[model samples]
Target: MLLYTAMPLELVLDGIDRKYNFKEIDVDGIKLIIEPIDINHGKIVRLISTNPQDYLNSELSPGKIIEFKM
Candidate 1:
């Protein structure tokens, strides 16, 4: 996607200064997308696991806070 404009790059791009803190982690062989809430905890963003069983676990659903180690 290309957008040609006379505006400055900073002005043309929106929210470029915002920080994105998304992280991926593999917990017990299941993959997940997490947004950190603290040093040791993060809120679940989504399951990136290929196994269907990982999605079936209600505890792994989005918005659930889970503790993780770096």
Candidate 2:
């Protein structure tokens, strides 16, 4: 499976409902919402990818972690 590294941009239980037109790669097609402070500046970015596996679904519940190309 393709891999993705996503950094939290904001964290809200129902954050998707707030965004006007957000798109994600989860089986449910919803992107996870996380706060920018949770991730390191050098980590991966959010959205901007067509590959479903290119992003880590923040809704994983236990919390999301991503690995990026060095």
Candidate 3:
């Protein structure tokens, strides 16, 4: 069986060169963590907004999978 069911993901930039710990997501009840990785084309970005702008802005890994979001 699959350990996790993939869903939509939302991430905010936390900071550069920082380590993030895995935790449960309030949106979908899935655990997730994001660590810094190579920059994508020399640019760092993340999912900064939700449908209703409920999530706050923070630095995050460019392609790190934080967790599943419904």
Candidate 4:
């Protein structure tokens, strides 16, 4: 199963991580490293990958809705 969110990633992920403590996610057969970046007011979510070119070519790129396996 896959779950997608249009809401702010930080809000949704922070809450979910607090409850479940998940560190990574699998989407489209790729394992993404999830990290949080603190800015001035709040934190933003960052998804890291070893093959960044592949990641950029995937549906998980910027301006696309993020999808994750549940």
Candidate 5:
């Protein structure tokens, strides 16, 4: 993990900002990361759940489109 260089830290860490906007929302106790496609819909970026059974839901799969308010 050593960066053996004389370049400034800012220069070396450039372009770290995310271009796509991802929002975290909790629906029915399951947390999800969503990438908005429109005002009321988004594509599921990831699902955060502790239960292994929660991950089996097809609708919660990444890349699936879902509706959301706000």
Candidate 6:
């Protein structure tokens, strides 16, 4: 298991439906769900794994940076 840390980039979705609020991304072949907690502060994100075992084995502590690519 590996831990990733970095400053998370805020994604501004334009012309997107509110119903589709969550963002999905693939990291190292692992599918993760990025749920926005507070848009105003741009801090405190919830990273959810599709597999529960992966989530339990992995640790995403505070002060870790989150990076994204295009």
**TM-scores of the models, in the order given:** 0.67, 0.19, 0.16, 0.30, 0.71, 0.33
Scanning candidate 1 in windows of ten residues, the lowest lDDT window is 46-55
lDDT (Cα atoms) of all candidates against the true structure: 0.88, 0.39, 0.34, 0.48, 0.92, 0.47
Better of 1 and 5 by lDDT: 5
Clashes of each: 0, 4, 7, 0, 0, 5
Candidate of highest TM-score: 5
**lDDT tens digits, residue span 1-70, model 5:** 8878899999988888849789999989999999999999999999999999989999899999999865
lDDT of 5: 0.92
- Compose the digit string of candidate 2's lDDT tens values, residues 16-70: 6664432233324544443333333122234444656645545343234433223
RMSD (CA, Å), candidate 2 to true, equals 15.2
Q: Which residue runs does candidate 6 get wrong by more than 4 Å? A: 1-20, 36-53, 57-65
lDDT of the structure predicted as candidate 4: 0.48
Per residue, candidate 1 scores C-alpha lDDT tens digits across 1-70 of 9989999888878898889899998888888899999898999998888788888898899999998766
**7-60, model 3: which lDDT tens digit per residue?**
533333236556654222222332223332333222223333344333332323
By TM-score, the candidates rank as 5, 1, 6, 4, 2, 3
Which candidate number has the best lDDT?
A: 5
RMSD score of candidate 1 (Å): 4.8
Candidate 1 steric clashes = 0
Comparing 2 with 5 on lDDT, the higher-scoring candidate is 5
Show where candidate 2 strays beyond 4 Å: 1-28, 37-59, 67-70
